[model samples]
Target: MKYLGIILSAIGLMIIINSCSKSWTDYSALQVQNLNQDSNTALNNKTYQTYLANLRSYKSSKHSIVMGWIEWGDKTSTANSTLNDLPDSLDFISILNPSNTLSDEKKQDLSSVQKNKGTKVLYNLNLQNWDDSLYSTFNKIGYLLNVDSAFQSQLDSVILAINSLGYDGVDVNVEGMNCSSCGSFFYTYQTGYYNRILDTLGKLYGPHSNTEKFLLVEGATTASLLSGTESYFNYYIANTNDYSWYYQVDNAYATIAQIPGFTNDKLIITTDFNDKSVSADISDKLWQYGGIPFYTNGSGTPIPSSTALLNWNPTSGLKGGMGIFYINYDYFNNDFTITKNIIKTLNPSGE
Candidate 1:
């Protein structure tokens, strides 16, 4: 009887161990399945907006949209290049300052521009560096990704400022997204943060306005980092150089095209007009890429436009119209002579 009792206890212990093992196996399999399902889901579920598409006829104004950067931080005063100085041909200008904290003079310039010019003033926020004291949201991206709600409304204040200023919308330019020190997990979490803010801005803009320019990544441009993120933005202002503008623009667009959701037409090449090499035939080159070429003044004399460019419409070419930067730069001057010449070439009737 003692041996039988001992055997019964042993059997009961074995059965209990087997039951627990089975439960664990089932739970692990369930977790793996859920992970696989979530992996296939797109980061952005909302469809890309197409209301103000066709960079060829941007803003329904028939002329290609010109984008200029009124960059702050430079000690130079933009007091001369106020909205009044911007021509009727200008489409969009981004306030590429670091923070909303503007000087009194800047505030007056912006307020006047928005109230009078009717030019779409986009708020350009730079979330590039991870300063310990500033932009705490960027400090611990891994933590923030999980609890994104904490500062999700933080961007709202900038938007509200835009509204109060009567500006068109906001343009976000994020850098340092690929932090080598933090590793791939940083990319993952930062990507998550971008996805979250994009969703938020999409809701803010609803169906009408261009919600955000958040995908312009300075750190990483890999398929892993950039692919689906393009769907979140409608317009992107790409920067290229004078010497290699053609191939540079081509490569940039190719990367953007890899996003599956982005087409060739979604990109606008905002080149530095400081290039003297900008011949009359440059438009033909931009058209070939199915993009609009916007030349913002930087330095040097931009190649003057001829009547040939005004009339030469190509059937084989894709025509994404073109424009220039704001009215001033030390080298280019506030008068924007080169930009005006290009605009005159595009819209000869206005001349």
Candidate 2:
């Protein structure tokens, strides 16, 4: 009888321990599940926060700034909207291929149409001087936009005329920035001397209420990018369109956001969308760098290589959004179905 009692007690004790063990196991699993849920929620919130910050930075402006170019032949009049309203998604449109014939009346009309939609249309100029008598290939750029006062008087007159026209701002193209005559002086004499042009223009014409002194520099060279002249301008349109490099994406993020430390909010990266080799992946890589992204399709192919306006679906970070090189090129296709399709894809209108 004593032996049997002892055996029975031992069995009971084993049963109790087993029951307690199972309870702890189940509790541990529940705790793990709760932890996973918390982690997931935090990740989602981080992305949302990033997006909110980018949006708020622009003061309720769309997280993306949809922009494009309007060439002269593509429109009916100065302010024509046939090519512009295609996607109904543009935020900035500049008149391109400057013909050097902008009169005060013409500038007034351009502003009126774009203003109706809150679109910013700036006066786009090349080194080509509107004062044809003073024009040389890039002589105007060399002379007027130098480190010296060589062309300050001419610049003042140009600024006066452009401001009178009531443009939102200006876009200046510095072609052949690496040309021999751009001078060792640009590198040696002064830092960001090139920006003197933008600074002068910005001060003369602006402090615009909407754009906040809008001035953009196109075709920025490697020298300017490294020298930090770019920071002075509102937008720095870089020409590093080669996506074929294996580490191009990583390098771009590091170069802009990490090294020199400019976010997508400031940098505007260009991609050649017309290249068949670079299609959907372009926007993804550019977005990772945290800057405004734009792709180019030249006069020949009205059709975009990707047939998609943007390809960003932010889950963890922000994609400030992308725009096009030339809105007018769509006229070649005689329809914007292709562009319309693109702007709606992976976009707020995401497919």
What lDDT tens digits, residue by residue, belong to model 2 across residues 57-134?
332343445566665343243222332333334445666654445644444445433432345666676543322333
Worst 10 residues of 1 by lDDT: 1-10
| Position 296, candidate 2: lDDT | 38
Q: Candidate 2: misplaced stretches above 4 Å? A: 1-60, 74-87, 99-109, 125-147, 174-192, 202-211, 219-233, 240-253, 258-261, 271-309, 312-316, 349-351
lDDT of 1: 0.42
Using TM-score, give the best candidate's number. 1
TM-score of 1: 0.56
Cα-based lDDT at residue 294, candidate 1: 30
- lDDT (Cα, 0-100) at 22 in candidate 1: 25
Off by over 4 Å in 1: 1-60, 72-79, 98-108, 130-153, 174-181, 206-232, 241-245, 258-265, 273-327, 330-334
Q: In model 2, state the lDDT of residue 326.
A: 53
Model 1: how large is the Cα RMSD against the reference?
Answer: 27.0
